[model samples]
Target: MINDSGTLAQSHLLIVDDSLDELRILKSLLDAHHFRLSVAFDGLQGYQRAQTLRPDLILMDVRMPKADGFSACRLLKANPQTRDIPVVFLSAAASPEERLTGLSIGGVDYVTKPFLAEEVLARVRIHLQLASRHMDTQEGAAEALDPDEVLLQAGIALIRSRLGETLTVDEIATRVGSYGKKLSAVFRERTGLTVFAFLREERLKTGRRWLADTDTSIQDVADQLCFQNAGNFATAFRERFGLTPTAYRKSVRAGRLIEA
Candidate 1:
């Protein structure tokens, strides 16, 4: 089903490895599966190809001559141009800790060296399917919220109506799914955040407002945000706003800040 024309009918893959023999083997294996393939010999070239080709997925090697896969993955994740691209590390590093480090650095999956072709294909298929679903969700979200003002208004309405209650992804999805996935995508596209991220931001904003405007204690604010405990609430608040609840309240009281 894959073709060289770069359409959805054909999935495009970029394989990056220092070993020409390994690349050829992988290319042959994927070719048999009808995947349109591209190759890069090193991490630098891989990064460039990823940006220019915009392949559906990337298979990256861990250790290479210039710019290793981990560094490249971190670079790609940091760049807005390629942050959303799913990278799968095809490496000889088989330790659990090594695999975890690869994932933590932005690789979505890791396949060790000498992997079976079937296993490789299966993992590739799964990641490609997820990327396709994410794209579909984004497109649907855009179409649902063609009007920018309407989406913002609805998002605000959701915040107002749902505040002080624990929000779930399903709840947010249900509310936005009414118009279609397009609305959800539109909200994320416009705000540069997922539905969950937006909800968390709103919840934090509300919590900060309460802390600043009312005589409520930090525990109350945590409860208001439906956070399980004050510690979790404080951690999330600090991570989001760079301040503890008490510090935030003190800043607000001193007129140093308005909102989180």
Candidate 2:
């Protein structure tokens, strides 16, 4: 579980990829950033590792010899023990449709080949922060509520359940509105955040779980979170979380040592 401060404290990261070169590249990148990294060369091993280690995040390659990223992602998502862990797809297939398919099948993000180190770190940071927030919301006491607070909570739940799908404030308003302005004002007053802010925060929280626990790449994390590009994801992630994604992951892993 994560704390209110959005820190995992200490966490493990799993990296799964078929290509030794790619695995090394990712390992080196994450290592430079200070993550306590473990690696699996195939999908089956990756799945097994996840079942056993329950790492904070999984960075999975889309194409593998057996039990490809998609199938593995589906299996993990279906399994209650591992379902909450985030999976991001790292692949060379750079098409909108392909990216959508990745996101549709339980992937939180996608990253094409030829990624940048900074971009990768950024996405990782954003998703980790997001995961921390989700854990906080789940574990924290539900804030005291008024009638409007009830509606806002409902809206938040709806948004969380549909993170992979597209959503808009207007759509949310239509669904939750007894009256538009009154509900919106009450929601902001109670939460001290706009409806969209709440939604974005929720998305980021979901993204963070994947980042911290899954073996998915940072680019894939960005894709899963619906960021336009890796660069944008990194910027937003850094802005939200004080450290780079790599640094945050490292910190969590380091903290885990004391807990153990």
Candidate 3:
């Protein structure tokens, strides 16, 4: 729900287009609305920016040099981190087919070029509200989301649910009704991490949490997380977090944790 101060102040918007004039106008309008903004000159840059910045919404132009807006949208939707972000396409093309293509590929709305300033603002606000509501109730909307997105979510859930197990990428893929090669490709495309890498990171994270919150010995922690022994666990932990498990636990207890 929008607060009394207005939700626009907390909103971040990404504008992707090739035209400098269009960007300038859109930037000015959104800035006046008190929305934080980021700009990308081409579709490729826009996709990269969205992945990193995670803006609340995107205003994408249909045509560009490196990658067109439609292609970029496809990549964004495939990525789990950026898929939920609302995309509003801004195109010079007024044809029904173009707008339909944008919506069919996961865009939330379309705004034709030479758009009215007020209309753009209204649409942006409306979609942002809708996106915010969806985020608040995402669990209920999970079944309606894109299948690839649902697949990625389910795969991550499986990994977390079995963090202590010595599971392989092939096993995870099969359990999720996919093959190793295909799942790995999707994981890389959607999360920028291979399944194996993600599993390793999750294991380390669980170890860190146990160290900070539990009195479990390092050896037991290692054993539970499926490491061969404490020595192997300590080595991997230090390499990942720049401290031995003992040191990390001590620092947390002392309430003077050093940067890792």
Best by lDDT: 3
Evaluate all candidate structures by whole-model CA lDDT and list the values in order.
0.75, 0.69, 0.84
lDDT of 2 by residue, 156-248 (tens): 555665666676666655443334575467668888887777767776666566767776777887787777766776676667765555655
Off by over 4 Å in 2: 1-10, 139-260
Misplaced by over 4 Å in model 3 are: 4-6, 139-260
Pairs with backbone N, CA or C atoms under 3 Å apart (clashes), candidate 1? 140-181, 140-182, 141-181, 141-182, 141-183, 141-185, 141-186
RMSD each, Å: 13.9, 20.0, 15.4
Using TM-score, rank the candidates from best to worst: 3, 1, 2
Candidate 1 Cα outliers beyond 4 Å, as residue runs: 1-8, 139-260
- For each candidate, what TM-score against the reference? 0.53, 0.51, 0.54
Residue 163 error, candidate 2, Å? 22
Report the CA-based lDDT of candidate 2 relative to the real structure: 0.69
